[model samples]
Target: MIKLMKSTFYKEEETKKALANFILEAEMLSMGEECKKFEYGFAQKQGRAHALYVSSGSMANLVLIQALLNLGRLHRGDRVAVSSLTWATNIMPLIQLGLVPVVLDCEKETLNISSQTLQSVKATDIQALFITNALGFSGDMEQIRKWCSENEIIMLEDNCESLGSQVSGIKLGNFGLASTFSTFVGHHFSTVEGGMICTDDEELYDMLLMVRAHGWDRNLSAEKQRVIRDKNGIGDFFSRYTFYDLAFNARPTEIGGFLGNRQLQYWDEIVSTRENNFKRFQNCIESNDDFLSLDVRHMDVVSNFAMPAVCRTHESFEKYRKRFENAQVEIRPIIAGDMTKQPFYKKYVTNESLCENADFIHKNGFYFPNNPELTEEEIALLCDLLHK
Candidate 1:
């Protein structure tokens, strides 16, 4: 029977072995040198100047919002344009921080917030755009970046689903002011449960460090920490227990760090396998009139998080849903479906017309397993069931 995800970790044996070694020899289990090492390696890989480790991807998004607010890059009640086809946490932080969210529609072709959607907002009050590279599919980011710059809009990326994806030689996360990644169990990499925020902005990076902890100066560099302590008129001993700003305890453990380092070693193999599976899956459904698949051929690399299948009609959805279920394959709605349909959103969002495409996707779109661990035979069998 085919399943959505086989296990928590892609390379379970190797991951457990690494964790075991660290557990035996590690001096401390808290967020420390190991977390620092993992963060540095992740930053280098993503081509960012800094990376901050957190307990979960949800926390990564939350801390990023706080960091932006703390640095005055964004303010309370500012209108933040968000993808209507995003996860709950992506919008939750915006609401939690008292920011107004203007839900943007997704392109039917890419299933992402395309440049056209950005232009359709028509709201001049939009100070920021928090976009999600949904399920490894990205829109024309180069054009979007140019537009954001011209309009003075601060762009942030929720790249939790598109970690290894790239477009025209440029990485997706690099186009925005700051971007986030998740190493959740079913994600591209598995550190059990962990997340990262990457950015080139030095001041924003410093603030993120404090935001991940309890807004303490301890995580900051000695020079920076000293400056804050001196400015606050607090001595070294007293500053050790001081909380400087609004934040949360979202730090990851050493075990999570060790697993991340080990998982990164197999990065190429993992991505290549997922991409190959994606192509094979696409080939199987290209001729099937019942389904509509997004065109991702333009993407230089695609680290597919899941395979999205948009049924042409409600009848087709029921037919395919039954087939997959009978075959023991799992399925799920696309990224929590339309964000506006969520219970929490209904209370805050009144104008549903802005999310037309998102509403269409929510009604028609569903995703299935696209993990790297599937063998060629397994992939073929899964495709056969899908086509049947």
Candidate 2:
């Protein structure tokens, strides 16, 4: 049976062996040098100034929102536009943190929010945009960036699904003021269950470190720690025990750091394999009349864990879903479809807007596996299934 993912890391057996030895020899298992090293490597590779390691992708979003609030970058009841096609956690932080969320619809072709989508918004109060680069595909991000800049909207990327994807020569995570990533088992990089928040803004970066673990400066650089401590008059007695701002316990274990380090070595190989699989999947789906053609010409790479098949109708969606299931191929509905329709969103948010495209995708979209480990035979089978 074809599964979403066959292993935890790119080289699972080897990674487990290494992890076993590391655990046996390590004097400490808490956040340490290993975590710092992973952060540095991730920041360098993603072309960002800072990358803060977190416990999970969901926590990454929470920490970012809390940091913004603590720094006075955002305030209670401030409107933040969220992509309607995103995962629940992407928009939950807004509702959870007392910020208003305005649902932004995505384009049908790109499976992402375009500048045109922003233009269609009648709401003039949006302070920020929490945009999700869905399924390793992005809209015309350059135009989106320009639009956001002109509108003075602070754009943040929920780039958890599009880690290695590049558009117009810039990585997906670099297109916004800051971005979040997942290093879950099946994501582009795996550290079992981990996340990262990347940004170039030093103020935001400093806030993120403090916010990750009970709002303490323990994780901050000496200079940042010194500055915060000095400002708060936190002397040697209370410095370590001081809790500065609103935050969470989103700290990653040293094990996550070690696994991240091990997985970082195979970033290129993993990304290349997934990109190639995406191309093959694209070719097959584009030729099928029942499935919607995905527009990805703007992307230099697509490093996704799964390939979506947006069928022409709900009946078609069921037919294809059944085909894959019968073939023992695992599949799931596209990223918590039409987030506005979610029960949690409806319960919390009052202002409603039509997201026709996102609603349509909810009824028609289902994604199949496109992991790096797909064998040539598995590819042929998946491709054959994509056909009529």
Candidate 3:
């Protein structure tokens, strides 16, 4: 049966070859040279100063939040504003650190954080904001960036779904102070299971690296550590084990890194194909506006087109889902839609009111096929079924 999301596994032999070389060259697989190489490649793609490979998208978010807290920008029980429609990982890291998660509503159009509601919410001691790029749609980054700047709030983009998406000329991940991405199966690219954190701040990047590997300085260059010690006038050997910061083991495997490195080479092509598929899906559904609704507002903001479509109501969604199922086409709901409905979230997140848009999407929105490898005829068939 066709599945809602499938991993793009092109050039399997090439990936296997790279994995074999990594295995032979680096006997120990935890954050080795291959991981370093992947980080560099990923950073270059995002046009950022640094990238730290992590075990998963969740871990990437966890490390970034922990690093922010270590920097004293956030304290235990401090409030962090986040979208109510995001994956649990997006908010869990905050709760895990004893930070209160203030769930915000999302825009029905973009399915990202609602900037209007964001401004209306009474500001408390919010140390940071965690925003997700819902289903590859680049959120209102310009507005969000300005809002964060004016308020002096730390911004972290949960870019796991919008890896290749861009607003104007700037990429989504680069818009925030620290952005996290997933290279898990069915993402824009895959390394079986992997994630990355990218940023231009060297201090933040270094903190991320330390946190990624158990608060150890083993990954730091001797000169770098020497400079830190020299500045503090500390003894060399004594500072080696001195855990100056709280950290965790979020390191990625060398094999995953190797796969990521290979996948990075084809990012542009993959993104382009996904965009084309999105246009095709839009065209197919445009005539059936009676039953379907497309949320894309502009063409300037490029979407990764990861899951491509959004239905307006639950009844229409069920009809389309059933039709697609009858036609053997697969579709699924958008990411964790309306996370407040989740039991775990109810226990962890605190908010006075629920987000109606997030709840609307949770029950109504679903995704259709957008695989690059799928032929035109196949896409058309799927679209026909969706509109039928």
Candidate 4:
């Protein structure tokens, strides 16, 4: 049976071997040396100075935002702008921290946040801008980066969907002051359940490291420990139960880090296969434009082709979904559509403006399966069924 989504867990034998080795060395899992190695390797691949492993993508967001707040870059009750169409985790940290979430409408073509609307918003005491690379499409990063820099807003990207995506050769997660990634089962990579925060800012990196582990001073280096001791007095250090900053337990298991490291070894091949599948899907869908128009415009706009197509309307979408299902093809909606419609938002968020493009896509858009295990003939058959 066709599934709506499938995990990209290739190299099972290699993964098992890695896990076995890790277990043999250390049975009890906690953020340790292996986690540090994985963090360093991940940061290097993304061209960032530091990457911190966390429990999940949701925790990654929380830790990053809370770190920014602790550093005085962000404050409670300040307005933070985000795309209306995004995963709930993308905006929850803002609400959880008492930051006001200003939802921006999305562009119909790319299904990403509208830079036009984002620019038009009256710049109050806006603390940060959270942008998601919708599905796998790297939104207009150049423009958004320029806007955020000029406005002095903290730029944070939710890159959970677009792990390997780049814009003009610059990686998506690198564009933000800090970015979050998920290595959940079905994403570009798998760690059984893990997430990471990538950034070049030293202070932000240090803050995340501290907050991710119960706000303890233990995470700090000897130099930082000395400074803290000097500032707060050595007696403060003895007060082990004392909390230095508002933080949480967002630590990932050593096993998750081990799995992530193994997965990173095959990232290039995995991304390439996904890209080929994307091209095939694009060609198939474009060939049938007489009846349907795909929302994806170009290859660079998307990173690894996470979600392939965007249909024109809800009626056509329903028809196509039904047709594909009957033919043993699987499809799923794009990122829960417009997130403002979420019931939780009704109580926590205020702006009632219906993002027409986001709403349209929410009702009309669906994604095709992108598993690497599928053979060429299977893809061809799926394409034929989609076209038919």
Number of the top TM-score candidate: 2
Q: How many residue pairs clash in each candidate?
A: 0, 0, 0, 0
Candidate 3 global CA lDDT score: 0.77
Candidate 4 per-residue lDDT, tens place, 1-388, comes to: 5553454366777678768877998966888877888998999888899999999998999999899889888889889988888899888999999888888888866668645668657765577899888767755788888888888888899999887766777877988898999988878888878899999898888889889988877878878877876787666548476567899999998888888888888777777787777777777777775234545543353445355566665667777878877877777777676778899888788875677778877777777777666677778777786574
- Candidates sorted by TM-score, best first: 2, 1, 4, 3
Window of ten residues with lowest summed lDDT in model 2: 116-125
lDDT of 3 at 165: 74
Which runs of model 3 end up more than 4 angstroms from their true locations? 21-28, 230-240, 290-292, 298-301
Q: Which candidate has the top score in lDDT?
A: 2
TM-score of each: 0.97, 0.98, 0.92, 0.94
- Candidate 1 local lDDT, residue 9: 89
Q: Looking at candidate 4, what is the lDDT of residue 261?
A: 82
232-328 per-residue lDDT for model 2 (tens digits): 8889788978999988999999999999998888888888999999999999999998999998888888888788889998898889989999999
Question: Per-residue lDDT of 344-376 in model 1, one digit per residue for the tens?
Answer: 998876655457777777788788899988877
- Candidates in order have lDDT scores of 0.86, 0.91, 0.77, 0.79
Cα lDDT tens digits, model 3, 1-388, are: 5554554454667777767776887768766777888998998988999999999999999999999888777889888889877888988898799898888888877778745768856655577788888787755688888888888888889999887777767888988898999888877788888888999998888788788876766677788777767776768777767665799888888788778878888888888888777776667767676344555664354545456455666777777767777888777777776777788877766564677878777777777667666776787787677565
